[model samples]
Every structure is written in structure tokens, then in C-alpha cells.
Target: MASIAMLVFGGNAHAEGGSYNVDDASVVGAGKCQLESWLREWSHGSNGLYAVPACGAGPVEFGVTLNTGHGVYGPGVNPSIKWQLRNGDDKGIGVAVATAATWIHGRQDDAQAYVATTFGIDDARRLMVALNAGVDRIHGESTHSLLGLGMDVALTTRWTLLVERMWTHRTITDQGGIRLAFGESSLDLVVGSERSPHPSHWINLGWNAAF
Candidate 1:
């Protein structure tokens, strides 16, 4: 019952931008239910789940994120699914690969797929950053390309931070935002803002739980 509720409210069931409410509930497991309600108002309005194997044999990590936003399809919202892989030194030097798909629903429902790669950097302290670039294809129209860059900084062992910006030739589509994470698995706070050239800007705040 609780898991189902979190999935509905925390998954950006009704969002308009590429970001989701701050406390992106999906990141937490099943033990932090107490913080869900408040988190609905404090996050970036995007949900992402990631897994990193205990850096051992060869420094490999992978993760995924679901983005809820509007796109080439129409006024309806779309879901963007992504898979990422990283390989390099424990200090954070290496290459990262990512591929994502978005399904747009409505009049003419269109789907898009994107693939990108990034270079990683790690100061090893509390700050880290990565860069990515890729191309996007819209089923029937010309293939639209994109160049994106982002950074992640861990303020502490339990607090993670994110900043991302992307540019494209199309109007009313460029976007970016920031995210902050706190706690381990059950409690957290997130704040973020995003914009599009149509030109609208939105702010989000959320608190989340996983029990």
C-alpha cells in the first residue's frame, strides 16, 4: 500500500517540465515512508534511481532515471527512461555512456531515443563533475541533435548535489535545473528550478520517505 502511494506521487505523475518534485521518492528504498508528504513539495520534480557496485574488480557503475516532461508529441507529458554506465579510476577518471527513450502521448503520439557519453572527473573530496553530449531522434521528422553538460558535487557523504544545462536549436525546449539530496534511504530534501524558452520557469521543493 505504501509503496504504491509513493510510486504514484513521487514519480511525477503530473509534471510539466523535465524536473520533478524535490524529494524524488523513487531514490529511497522501502523504509522511509514518514518523509513522503513533505517531500512532495521540496524536490526538482524528477525521479531517478541509481546503483553503483562496490568499486572492486573494475570500477563500474550504472543507473537510471525517469524524466517526466513535455516534448515534440504534444501537450501531454512524456516519460524519459535512461541507462548509464561508468568505468574508470577510483579517483573518478573515465568515460560514461547513457541512452534514453521518451514516449510522447497524444495526437500523433511520438517516441524519441537519445544516446550520449560523458567524461568524468573527481577531486576525490566533496566535489565532482561530468560532461555529456548526444543526439536525439523524433520518429518522423529530422533528427534533432543536442549538446549537454552537467556536474555533480557531493556536499557530504549523505548530501549529493546536481546541476545540468542543455542546448538545442528548437524553441521552447532548452532546459536545465539543480537538485540536492540528503539522508541515506528514508529522509531527504530537494530544491530545483527549470526553464524553457517559450519562456517559463518553475521552482520545486520536496521532502521524501521510503518506508
Candidate 2:
């Protein structure tokens, strides 16, 4: 449980501008859940488990944001790994791959890993194109698959924009969001929706800082 929280928090940290440097790659992310009801936590000893079991690895540093219309919870950890193919001058490029997984109340939950191929022009203007694919086991009885493609743009040194569309093999998802960096700290907001077979939405908001 503690480890799971740590991973989430770590992702949040990187998103918050903690400076994730991996083989020349630096990453930042922020967003909000489209719906609030889907984001629920386990009650102590109430879920018939010691804690939600989870484990993952990535850049060793990350940041996250969870947002609700009523309030916000943020700067969480995440599991991610980033590799920089080129890091210098105004032109830079890299590839980052990461995944974070957890089981809520033994319901068997998991999040797929994403691979982002990013390129930047003039250092401040960043463009990222990526894909996500993963599977989840639910209720010890069923398994679900996820696939997605997304893009991100840095408006400036302090602002970023992102848009994505995903499919769970069983459902469709639409994600749109933005990010802001304040010196050593950062914040993010994102909105998501299910568009194909049904109608649903979620939002996420997060904040984090460097060590």
C-alpha cells in the first residue's frame, strides 16, 4: 500500500517539475480525471486487504495530479522510465516508456504503459506523440485491454497542452488537458470522456516539486 502510494506520488512529483533526467530525457505531465466517482480510495481494513498491492519501475522520479470538481489531491508518485536519444541545442528528441499498476481492494486493477516519441524545436516548443497498450484483471474473473494514442505541445516555458484518444478494446476514451510549471513546482489539469460505445467522463488534477 505504501509502495503503491509512493509510485503514484513519484509520478506526481515528476509532473510537478521535479526534474526527471534519464539518459538525457526530461519529462513533465499534468492532467485531470474526467469523472470523480471513478476515483475512489480504499478504506482502512474495510476492503478485506492489508492495502492495495502495487509495483512498477521507471525514471526513478515522477509527478501526478488528481482533481475533483469539489477539491484536488496532488503531486503523487508514478513509475516511468525515460531515455534520451539526443539532448542538445535547440533540437532535441527522446523516447519515454512507463507503466503504473495497482489492485484496488483485490478487485485486480492495472494501468498500461505508454511509449512517447518526443521532439522539440527551439528547446521550449515540445511536441510529443505516443501510444498506450495494457491489460487489467478485474474481480479475479475478467481481464480488459487498453490502447491509446496521444499528443502534447508546450505552449511556453510554463504552459503545455495535450490531447489524446484511447480504446480499451471494450470502450473508447477522449482525453484533453494542460500543464503549468512554476519555477521548481508545477500543476496540471485534464478532462477525459468515453465516446464510442457509451458516454462517461473523468477529470484529474495534480501538483508536485523536486527534491
- Candidates' TM-scores? 0.48, 0.51
lDDT of 2: 0.37
lDDT per residue as tens, model 1, 1-211: 0111011112211001113211110121112212222222324333333111111112221222222332211223333323324333244443433333333343323333333333335446344443434554544666565544445466666555655454443522222334344452323233433243333333334344323
In candidate 1, stretches whose alpha carbon ends up further than 4 angstroms from where it belongs are: 1-89, 106-122, 171-183, 186-197, 206-211
Candidate 2 lDDT over 141-195, as tens digits, reads: 4666645455667788788886766555455655566778787555657555555
Clash totals for all candidate models: 25, 43
Model 1 TM: 0.48
